[model samples]
Target: MLNTNETRIKYFFILGFPGILPEYYGPVSALLFLFYLAITMGNIFVLVFVKCERSLQKQTYYIFCHLALTDLLFGTVTLPKAISKYWFNDSIISFYSCLVQMFFVHLIGAAHSFILMVMALDRCIAICIPLRYNSLFSNKTVSVLCGISWLVPTMFMVAIMYEILRVPFCNSNIIVQCYCDHMSISNLGCDHVREVKIVALVLAMISLLLPLGFIILSFFVIIAVVLRISSIRGCIKTLSTCTPQLIITCLYYLPRCFYYLANFVGYSFSVPVQIVIVMLYSHIPAAVNPLIYCMQTKDIKEKLKKKLFSWKIDSTTKPMQDKTWQ
Candidate 1:
């Protein structure tokens, strides 16, 4: 219903936390900044520790490294802008920049889902068919799987972005979300809005549901395999290895599934509540994944302990050496 003379919007305003009071912005931004720091440092440590330690170079660790990289990229893409928006009251983003952010958000998110599916598959094969685990998931195979994770999502999102580009934006330029994404940006378009929404919803459902389904199925198989073990100690030991992945998988997928399902059913929450849910699912998993891995994975835990002990030793000895020199 918009006239052709209505000026095309050049930039968009992100109205993050729609009902939040001005006084609370600093505290919220500080919390977000802390999450950004945790995500950055933890994932970086995982990547570096895995890379430098030759003993950690294996199929499972390779998948973990890929996950760390994906999580780091996810936090980098989404968090800083939200942080700046709150800290500086800078919510304006140029149209193209928003599109670029949307593209990367979907791309990386899809890649992450696929990567998780790969992780589930990896665990499934390791547990179900231990004899051929290495042969099944070789270095080349992992590289191909990870490459496909990134590549397929890139191609899919590029197509979506192309469709998004064709839509004209001449109406409201305010996005009621912390960041730009397919839904938030597409909703601003004045033409083909419903069609775009339908297409986006369908694609999102496919992208999210497919991997989620696979993960669920994989876990079921893993549980069955674990239950079949005759000895209680062996079963407990096997289940412990899977516990971290299960925790992270639930953290990453469950909230997102709920949000998407709610959207599909046309049930809506308050704007602030919706944004909070999105942030909880998107940010918390990345921030917590490294901690879960470090605390649960025996190899990483031992290495971290050793590294910290060495640092502690150096810290105490350095002051003693300085006093002796004096």
Candidate 2:
């Protein structure tokens, strides 16, 4: 028998419910849509700019593009659906779509963490092993690393998707956190959730904790290496090269750790708190990445600026060139 008050079941799928009430949901919905659009466009620009610039063919820039792509997929998988729910005031997610949503959210979430870990390792290599770093993390090597990073999450996501399909959603349909979360869906399960929770907890710890520890350790080694270097100019150049990457790593990891902390403590926060966390690490990271590279790398900014102003100068000189030719 069906249990949820807001939705009806037609055998396998439970119709989704209307979104939040109009008294407050309207403005909040507007804000979410605008932010998602901004994040997508901003990250696309970063990826495009990086790919087009020949000077950015180094390992660091290659990893930066991968991070930007992860951020874009991360933002896209959930934000658009959240906007739809708010616009129609309907929160009813179908059984299959909800499963797909959770799969992608976790997939991109895992990829984002792995790519950051790779970036940290890249920084370590460039700083600690300058000469061999190029051959070590060349285009082919980086591509293979990125491929494995993406595929690891995909394998787990496929397993989870298979498990989710077997369970029946006879109890609830509304997901509270603006997007589908695994634990929230597990809470509505028709069977014992112990195995699910245990698997999820283990995966979460691995995905979150392992990379975090590596980053801290890498930085510790990085700092020591920098201190031992005799030349100040060489040290400054190395440190400057890594500043943008470190800023992005902090932006992604810091708030994600907080969100996991909240989940661990069994604390109940309002919906807005969840949204804030997504903004702090998840959505905001996508936009900040492009800006970070722009500000940190003067050559990139000069290239962008030249592209921007070239149109105007070309427009002004077109007629003059024609007259000179005559």
Candidate 3:
């Protein structure tokens, strides 16, 4: 029988930066607010620009837009509460609300992993088997892959959330991390902690490693195909196309894998260091992914330059036209 009286954790108090002194809170909050703003505006611009511009309506761009959307959701779900926690000292999140946040954090993250894998696959087909790239990755096929990226993660996260909900929380309500994640929340459960942790870990590995494996394989194949090109100019052109995706992939996966491995091995860092690593893996990619694409991809860079030039012309000309009319 369950003891109703013992299960009294109605809310969780998130300790965003337990080690930082009060004087630094404002600065930290300001920095986080900037990151949130950058992530929101950057991803929104990518999504909107891709939707409005027909020239960007290709298989690779479609996957890029999906990645942008995933980054937007991930940042929106986690950053606001963290900003509130530092800015106003408001860290109390209702138990169910924490669960909801945890669910979306993992859901969007898994979706991102899968989307990146799809991007790698797209590149692989384009580079390794150039003749059939269009036929292999048509609009319908891209849509189906993107749909699976989202839908499969949704089902997995739903199951993980169900398992988390069943864990009885009768202990401390303080979450040592910035936001409520699976491991952070499950650690507070009174019982079945090991089982819940194992289940969550297994699901997390499936979401991360499976996609990572495919991405590695795809990149290896791409490299091999690129190597067979005899011309120096051909090699440079082919490798340049993949550089941005490669950078973003490294930024997203490396820190996360390091953190997980450290935790799995029972190695601990100071609170501030740990928090920095977490934020690096979580927020940096979202804030910079669009910028990387805009700067690195020739089509996106040219289109963005054109859009900016037109906007400047309109702003300058509208004032002159109004004055002349008056």
Q: Show pairs that collide, candidate 3.
A: none
Q: Which stretches of candidate 3 lie over 4 Å from their true place?
A: 1-5, 262-267, 312-326
lDDT of 3 by residue, 157-184 (tens): 8888878878888877888899999978
Point out where model 1 deviates above 4 Å: 1-7, 262-267, 313-326
Provide the lowest-lDDT 10-residue window in model 1: 1-10
Tell me the lDDT of candidate 1. Answer: 0.88
lDDT of 1 by residue, 1-326 (tens): 22233546778888888888889999989999999999999999999989999989988789889888889999999998999999999999888899999999888889988988999999899999999999999878998999999998888887788788888887788888999998888877888778878877777777788999999999899999999999999999998888878888898888887887898899988788988998888989899999988998988889889989999999999999999999
As for candidate 1, its clashing pairs are: none
**Candidate 2: TM-score?**
0.87
Write candidate 2's Cα lDDT for 190-274 as tens digits.
6646677677767767777888899999999999999897999978877887788789888888877777788789976666566
